[model samples]
Target: MTLLDGQVWTSDIYVDGWRPGRGEPWQVREPATGNIIGRVGTATTEDVAEAAAKAAKAQHAWQNTPYDERAAVLRRAGDLWNVHSGEVQEWLIREAGSIGPKAGLETHIAAQECFEAAALPSHPMGDVLPSTEPRWSMARRRPVGVVSVIAPFNFPLILSIRSVAPALALGNAVLLKPDPRTAVCGGVTLMRVFEEAGLPPGLLQMLPGGADIGQALVTTPEVRVVSFTGSTAAGQAVGELAGKHLKRAHLELGGNNALIVLPGADLERATSAGAFGSFMHQGQICMTTGRHLVHESMHDAYVEALASTASHLPVGDPHRGEVALGPIIDEKQVARIHRIVKSTVEAGARLAAGGTFEGPFYRPTVLAQMEPSMPAYTEEVFGPVAPVVPFSSHEEAIGLARRSEYGLSLGILGDVGTAMEIADSVPSGIVHINEQTVADEANVPFGGVGASGTGSRFGGPTANIEAFTETQWLTARPQIAPYPF
Candidate 1:
């Protein structure tokens, strides 16, 4: 729905399965055109507390719900997702500023997560333990009660669903706080889908606001777990709050990922992968290849080929034809990227391809001969800019990759044995061979290490074990023993 000039649509914040919010409204703007897409209700602290208490109350009944019923609800939600995918995809493009391909991938992954989580109830729960005494002992996983999910604007659907689905599947209530910029698409849409799928009232809460709401959600005592996805600094704050309350925290934070191009690697394949890894969605992804490490033997040729490939990538309006690169999220992000590019070039790096912007659109950029001390090389440049550095030997390449504090994902292009060796040595959570650093399959764990995140995986069915569950040991005495008092 396009709003006329001076008109703004207001979307309410969901609490206790209803919109009881009367707080100030936060304006949601389309990054591509700077138009008012909608206005999301800014949840107050009281709203968060009420949501938490309601979720806790709702979880008491949900936890005891039959496994079959829970599975059916999730499956129905998945079905609804497919039915409304066209509309949801349009929302993603408009709200999150995602290109067509990126939006499709995110929507597909969100639906798949619901389907995967649907099977969590039927999966193996616990194991029996051999006991020395005349007793039977076993360990089983149980729901952690209420969980809080804080998602970022980029890939909002997938990030939120990855945690929300598992929490729901494990019979835990969820309070999701999506980035306010994407409130309608990521928050209201999810709540509607579950509600339409016969999910009980109060089982899920959707609050759209700024960091205050996120802080309130994490610090709420009734929230048993906090699953957060955003910048490293924000994740750290959430982790601290979770720790202070002794609540379980699962974090997927920022990443300055690296993609290595070896001497004998397929140049065409490497170039294509590098271009996609660096420029997709204007490189807002956490796992986007921020650094391209090339072996010195092929550094010059790789730089030229990569620059040529990146330059040809379609960049403009997301609603237009076959756009490979979309606008940066906002003016602040565009300015930050330009600053990084300018500083890197001043520090002796060469700008190979693109380094300009028209409105919010930042052309795909390549910086070669980058030193480790350069900000673009060391920091997470969350934009369509790849800083290339040359490594003379295998040891140097490994050292260069390891020098960063973020060990989220790594890509190495080489033979199988060599790739395996490099992958084994790298401290990243995900390592791809002959591929880009960014890849998210539904069945594999997706997260990071060190400052990148809290080292918790958030994908596949196993995600249920990460943030929404706790292990309990139960024992039965077969023979009664006399107690000495």
Candidate 2:
């Protein structure tokens, strides 16, 4: 059941010991422990080309399947996932290292969103231009064919489902390349649900592997579009390949999102929110509130509150709900967090609470007297550490928040009018008022600008309707008489 030495992991990928030669195996390490949980075939460039070729050969027939039929299949898959949510939750905790509550919520949300795809507009309408001579023009949304999904380790289940579901509903066959760490379990579970729900064989496939596999999937000639979510460096790499191959790609990458607390901002609410949000999952979240812009007046109070909250979080096994904080994804990620914190302190920021982490056990930390040029300040600190920067004026606050490669999400806590203005000025695609940057619901258009990400997810109509479809313009000129002008 485990892939090793470049072997395939699932029975689904083979018939009588047959496997894709191009997919050499890759390792999956548990984030909490640097232990190898499993291994799976990592697709080579040729493997990606072969898979895309298969999709091209089979995609048109799938695209012809009725919308209702596709919708029904996805709905049943949702039901199956709902029933087995606990098992999936266990896998998420074991692999991704998120605690019980967050993991459970993610599973619930990801599973339900599969059904949400059923609501996607099957027949995108085009209207005729009002003309006296009855000359008509219209447009239609059609599948682009062979959509490829490259998901991240932090959100292997949710991101994978979001990208592939909409594309599948719109009638494109999807090639899923999940993050190697949390890959097989969640992905294999959902795809099985779809198969049981009546998705035809070969219509949906999940290739659980690593970077080599990902490069294969995107560079394949037959893949019309690719959707990716990960680090900025990886995004740039993948984005480049997709462009060179002339393939469309949707990217959701890194972020160093900001949460500002002004003079009149709710002190109690902001502090509690800052702690829970920033430390959640040890801050391995893209939209985690890393930059805290506190007004000079509330600066001390907010930092103390955040520190008090951070100090109390218990870290260990994730299944316990009271354990509030769990391990960071892995030891390597722990090392990165250590380096950033060390660099920040060396660059003259004072640590108010936590600063050291061992293995995956990162202490929930807070820093005051921060400098913007520090790695922890400007880059995405994907760990359970929060840095507090004081601003003398509102204008200065906004200016400080804008300094990041990530523009994923922003938060403003203050008077409603001022909050709206701050939200409008912030460059992120998604904004939250009187809330943390990670406060997103099921179906809101969520993405970012700059290095954060390229496309949005959870779009109620627009995103769901157009994520994987193409538009064609149709024109009808009054039946031009035979060969007459």
Candidate 3:
């Protein structure tokens, strides 16, 4: 494991393989301290084109590689990650602004994703079809050639690998563009892992850059699929570019997720769920519980209990083991969140607790009496702010929850039958009963609907096959048919 402390960490674009990058370097900083922790090379437009071309060239041989051999690379990468868990965790904390538990969770899920992706080869992809005539027909899953992965800063390692590992397992050459803020961990570290794991050189390319680089990858003719996880606006642009180019896109975008507490809900458990869901990683997660819709019967009590719970959570340096919530990604984000909170208060919402900040660390805040019109209630706060609203009935609660354009995840606390019924009718992709909405399991399909994302999922055992590979139908005739020509 390499120590990055007090050193200017740097990584070049991996074109076909690891090599020195030609473009300028961008300074990567620690969000909490505003210190330059590293410098990562940025890819020029030409660099993205070079990587895509190399990936396209590499895909043919990689796709033809045996399933066992491909799976071995993923397994080796997972093993290597486990060996250096400490460094990975530290890098996540410093580079991505993640707290201790969030950093640990990222590395753990990333390793598990690699292991689960190793099983993609063993899963069923081809099937025999019945035919009426004297002939045979079957369908086979084939690689989509070059895949372009665009990952965000939050949960960089896990989110990037959530798409990268599976695409590689299915025999597609990948071009990964990690967020500039987390380039060291998200790009360079993963490149090292794959290289040491005996993956074929040139099969995985890492190009670290901003929007221009991402645009180049999406528009490149050699690329067949694009897997992206980020803000909804960026996703919309990616989708448009992919659509214009006639390429397959797997997008996991923003979420203004809601958590509803019913009349009979257990107060203690619900408060715990609310606190965890709302303040984890300073509520940076897309699936963070943004809105709390409690039944009018329990609204006041729930808010008080949730505020008391939030007060006990420690907020400070992520490197410290005792800290619960870390800083926002930057001062800009902190200001944005505070502005929303202030405006909501002016518009009649009550700040029950925590509407202030100390540097990058915005205290965990609880807002009550939030109406549907307030920005904090309608939009994604994307910070440690949980806004609670009262609903008179179950139908009203459902209506309020479904009002958002973004439908990614939802949490409901109610009886099994009623909760399940509500879950079925919700417009989100992942729904939880008596639990928080955020999930990081390897065997569950994770994506969103509507403004949250495109209708593409890339996780779990079965879902990866759909996004990285395309199906081809094969027909064979044992005898010649009656010809019309």
lDDT of each: 0.86, 0.76, 0.87
**Per-residue lDDT of model 2, residues 1-485, tens digit only:** 21122233442342112354355555666666667766655555655566667767778888888778887777777777777777777778777787888878877877667767776745553455565555676777788888888888786678778777777877888888777667655455556566667877666667766677788788777788888888999999999999999988788889898998878877998898888769887888888999999999999999888888888888876744458777877667888898999899989998889887766788999998888888889878899889999999878988998887678888888887888887777788888888888865556676788998785754555876666877787667757735656
| Candidates' RMSD to native | 2.5, 3.2, 1.9
Cα shift from native, residue 153, model 1 (Å): 0.7
lDDT at position 255, candidate 3: 94
- The CA lDDT at 3 in model 1 is 15
Weakest 10 consecutive residues, lDDT, candidate 2?
2-11
The runs of at least 3 residues in candidate 3 whose Cα sits more than 4 Å from the true structure, single-residue gaps closed, are 1-11, 478-484
Candidate 2, which segments miss by more than 4 Å at Cα?
Answer: 1-24, 34-36, 121-123, 130-135, 319-322, 455-458, 476-485
In candidate 1, stretches whose alpha carbon ends up further than 4 angstroms from where it belongs are: 1-9, 478-481
Cα distance off (Å), candidate 3, residue 223: 0.5
- What would you estimate as the lDDT of candidate 3? 0.87
248, model 3: CA deviation in Å?
Answer: 1.1
Candidate 1 per-residue lDDT, tens place, 1-485, comes to 32111123254677864554656877888888899877777688889888899899999999899999999999998888887888888888877888898888887887888898899888888899998877889998999998899999888898889889988999999999988888777787788789878999999998888888888998888988889999999999999988998987888999999898887888888888988898888899999999999988888888999999888888877865668877788899899999999998999989999998899989899998789999899889899998889998888888888989998999998777777877877799889998899889766788899989977568766666655788899899867766897
